[model samples]
Target: MPTYEFFCHRCSKPFEVTCSIAEYGRKIKAVKCTKCGSSKVVRRISAFQVQTAKKS
Candidate 1:
């Protein structure tokens, strides 16, 4: 599962949704704001961290 960040335009706050890629693609139309329970939410561009193999 991936954590997707979203911002609610109505509530002016941010929230996160955890789901699989397939689930998100299929249910992309069903995302709502957690604060105000509004469907007027937009996905936020968030940074993710990646761990690489350490050099010997």
Candidate 2:
């Protein structure tokens, strides 16, 4: 699963969704503003920050 960032033009709010890449891509096209219920949504560059252990 990956985290995705979305910008809502209708409500001028930013929201995040975590799902599989395929799920994200499919649902993203139909995403709407939770506040305004508008289809004016844009996908922004989402970050997946993680800290990993170094190999010994």
Candidate 3:
């Protein structure tokens, strides 16, 4: 699962969702607004987490 940032076009609110890539893609395709309940949500550019393993 990954975290995604979404901007609500209706209410102009920004939100984050933690879900799978497939789910996220579906949600983004739907573009449903969470705050104003409108199908006009905008997908915002988000930063991905990076992990580094220690060299033992």
Candidate 4:
């Protein structure tokens, strides 16, 4: 499973959920707002960091 970020349009809050890649590809259509219980949620582009080894 992978973590995905979501934004609730009703409460303007962001939340995360863990699901399979297939499920993620299917798209989230009925996700409820974790804070306000609203179904108007949209997927958000999450940022991640990549670390590299230092040069010798």
Best by TM-score: 1
Go through the candidates in order and give the C-alpha RMSD of each one to the true structure.
5.3, 5.2, 5.4, 5.7
lDDT of 4 by residue, 15-50 (tens): 987778778655566667778888888887644411
Which residue segments of model 4 deviate by more than 4 Å?
25-27, 48-56
User: lDDT of all predictions, in order shown?
Assistant: 0.81, 0.73, 0.67, 0.73
So what's the TM-score on candidate 4? 0.63
Name the regions of candidate 3 deviating beyond 4 angstroms: 47-56
RMSD of 3: 5.4
Model 2: lDDT of residue 50: 24
- For model 2, the stretches where C-alpha displacement exceeds 4 angstroms are 47-56
lDDT winner, 2 or 3: 2
**In every candidate, how many clashes are there?**
0, 0, 0, 0
TM values, all candidates: 0.74, 0.64, 0.61, 0.63
For model 3, residues 8-49, the per-residue Cα lDDT tens digits are 877888977677876865766775665677777766764333
What lDDT score goes with residue 24 in model 2? Answer: 68
For candidate 1, write residues 1-56 as lDDT tens digits: 87888899998999998889889886667999878899999988654432222332
By TM-score, the better pick of 1 and 2 is 1
Q: Candidate 2 on 1-56: residue-level lDDT in tens?
A: 76677789888899876778768658878877777888888877733332222322
lDDT of 4 at 39: 83
